[model samples]
Target: MGFSTTHLIIFLVIIIVIFGTKKLRNIGSDLGGAVKGFKDGMKDGTDRAADASAAPAQQVGTAGTAAKETIDVEAKTKV
Candidate 1:
């Protein structure tokens, strides 16, 4: 048979007993925070994507901070 409201309540009570209310509250807060952060990151990503599409592509010849981050190296073959 499918679970009734009473069965769900009993299950919740058991979980609360095992975990304790303080621990359950902390877990709930942490899970909520994680979900909030995930939502924020997704929104930021979409905003960045829209901005990128609206802006013109930068020229490769001129480098900004990206230039400073790169290192030029000559590859050598061992004899």
Candidate 2:
């Protein structure tokens, strides 16, 4: 049969015994922080993408900095 509430409780107790509450708490906090950071980074990236797509003529963050100059050159074969 599938695991019941009692079985799940026992499994959790065993895990707690193997890794004490303090260690588990630290691990949980670290995981939470990593997830939060990842979400923030994704949001920032999405905002930048939206800005870029919204205006093809003006790049994002152009209000603060000068426009970048571009150059083109053909690649040559190495000797």
Candidate 3:
């Protein structure tokens, strides 16, 4: 069966006794910070992926123009 409210309270009390309130508080804060950092890192990675994909499209657009410009330069240099 699932844990009732009383069982949950008893479990929490045992945990607090094993690890004092101060240590538990610090542990809780550290866990929260880790979760926050992980979320931020995931978001940053997604943004970088989006930027990386966009960059290739722009490079492709420029590549076509660059090839045309290079041919003109070569022709002029020969003349």
| Per-candidate count of clashing residue pairs (backbone under 3 Å) | 0, 0, 0
The best-first sequence of candidates by TM-score reads 3, 1, 2
Candidate 3 lDDT over residue span 1-79, tens digit each = 9999999999999999999999999999999999999999999999999999899889988998898767555557543
> Which residues of candidate 1, in runs, are more than 4 Å off?
57-79
lDDT of 2 at 41: 99
TM-score between model 1 and native: 0.67
Clashing pairs in 2: none
TM-score of each: 0.67, 0.66, 0.68
lDDT of 2: 0.86
Candidate 3 lDDT at 38 equals 100
lDDT of 2 by residue, 1-79 (tens): 8999999999999999999999999999999999999999999999999987888666546744653443334545557
Q: Which structure among the candidates has the greatest lDDT?
A: 3
lDDT of 3 at 15: 97
RMSD in Å for all candidates: 7.6, 8.4, 4.5
